[model samples]
Target: MKIATPNDRLKQIMKERNLRQVDVVKMSEYYQRELGVKLTKSNISQYVKGTSNPDNKKIQLLAKTLKVSEGWLSGYDVKKELVVSKSELSNHFDKIFQSDKIKLDLDFANQKYENQEHKLTFLALLENFDKLEEDKRKNLLHYSDVLLESTYQKDEYNIVATMFDNSMEPTYSEGDRLMVSFGFDFKFGEDYLIEYKEDILIRRLFFENYKILLVPLNDKHPTTTIILPLKDHFKVIGKIIGKIKTSP
Candidate 1:
């Protein structure tokens, strides 16, 4: 009744699971560059031959990437995914990755799959804009973060959107939230919310030849809200793509 060693367990799992060497190799492809230069089939064969052992970091990623307990590799996983985000907190994770995050009261999550490709993560938007402050009749320039130079183009992307008591009511009312596409230069087909001389407007942009149009929602009251076209009196503050509403 003796306990099996880590390597012993590794050999056992490989055999019982009927896993091929290439199976492990293909898993490693996820971080081929970070773990080291891209590994070829020949390199994988070398590790199987015992003539070469993967580097420490490489081995950890290899084991985790393949869902094999690290114990099966470095003799023990009594350890973890060894996360180290670049200072930017922006360049570390991939387009999609399984890693970690500090959320609410959870002490530690075994895994947190991060998706970077999402223009703006839905959860992030929800958390930032759950409630609104009084005296603020508009959302423009509120939670907005201007991007002067980002890899993606779509200026003024909405990170947080809310809908309640807004001129956009009936169509957009209480308890609605939206995900926005942002960071492209101002143009038509793009709906922007701008404040002119401190007056706020949530409207769509339409350019017809030499004229421009800024149309608002709920026009039953009509001219009470002035409708203008390319007036020298205003500037483009921002655009509204989507919004979410919470209890007023």
Candidate 2:
């Protein structure tokens, strides 16, 4: 009997839910924002196309978010209702991989860092963040033991995202880099990074009884006052706290 692979099972589940690729992308982002797990579009494509597999932690989260059992999702055993442990998954990857060169390189780098007296500087790589796959990146970081710089101090819940449009001109310009804080207190007539209808926008939020209004500051831009159901289509990603204007 031919048993289904994890990829096959994922496709089946997605099919059952009538989910598209873009829907999966949204689900992955939702998972990351709520759970701190990075699941990108690349990761979803890889998983569905059999190019890669998620770790046990990701596997569990995937099952929970997709409304499936771990065993069924991974195609381990149809009757077994269990989740694979992290250690077991790590051991599985190690055994399956033919080359250990990447692992060896990481080990050597770790030793060098341990013996060095210089302070290590860590900066968030801002380029192409939307294009990165969370699961693959997490696995690489785990395997390499890379430690990211802490943002727990004043910048806690803060992220830097570049603005590509001039919709909020005078307040925000094209090519400006914004320092967005996810922990900001929401208020009426405030500019925010909003998620609406599966699109990300930087606009002003207005209060209404049954609907919320997304208004642009620039009148010349001709943005229609988008009236959306208060809680359904509107999501606040973060508030724009600061900006770094690019020199013309």
> What TM-score does structure 1 among the candidates reach?
0.29
| Model 1 / residue 131 / CA error / Å | 25
Pick out the ten consecutive residues of candidate 2 with the lowest summed lDDT.
144-153
TM-score of each: 0.29, 0.36
Alpha-carbon runs more than 4 Å astray in model 2: 1-157, 223-232, 245-248
Per-residue alpha-carbon lDDT of candidate 2 for residues 1-248, written as tens digits (9 for 90 to 100)? 22767788888877755667656654454345446687777888898888887888777667755645777877766642234454653453343231122333344556555543522311122223224487654544433111121222233334444444457887776434466676788898888877676556788888676556688878776543555434357668788786632111
Q: Which 10-residue window of candidate 1 scores lowest in summed lDDT?
A: 96-105
Report backbone clashes per prediction.
14, 0
Flag regions of model 1 displaced more than 4 Å. 1-158, 161-166, 174-182, 185-187, 221-233, 245-248
Candidate 1 lDDT by residue in tens digits, 1-248? 22544444445545644456665454355455345546566655666556666666655666644445465556553532233234322222111011111111011211332445542454454333334343231222221212111123433343333232235555554223333444547777556655444444455667666556666566642322334453456766455655422111
Top-TM-score structure, candidate number: 2
Task: Tell me the alpha-carbon RMSD of every candidate.
Answer: 22.2, 16.8
lDDT of 1: 0.43
- For candidate 2, the per-residue lDDT at 154 reads 38
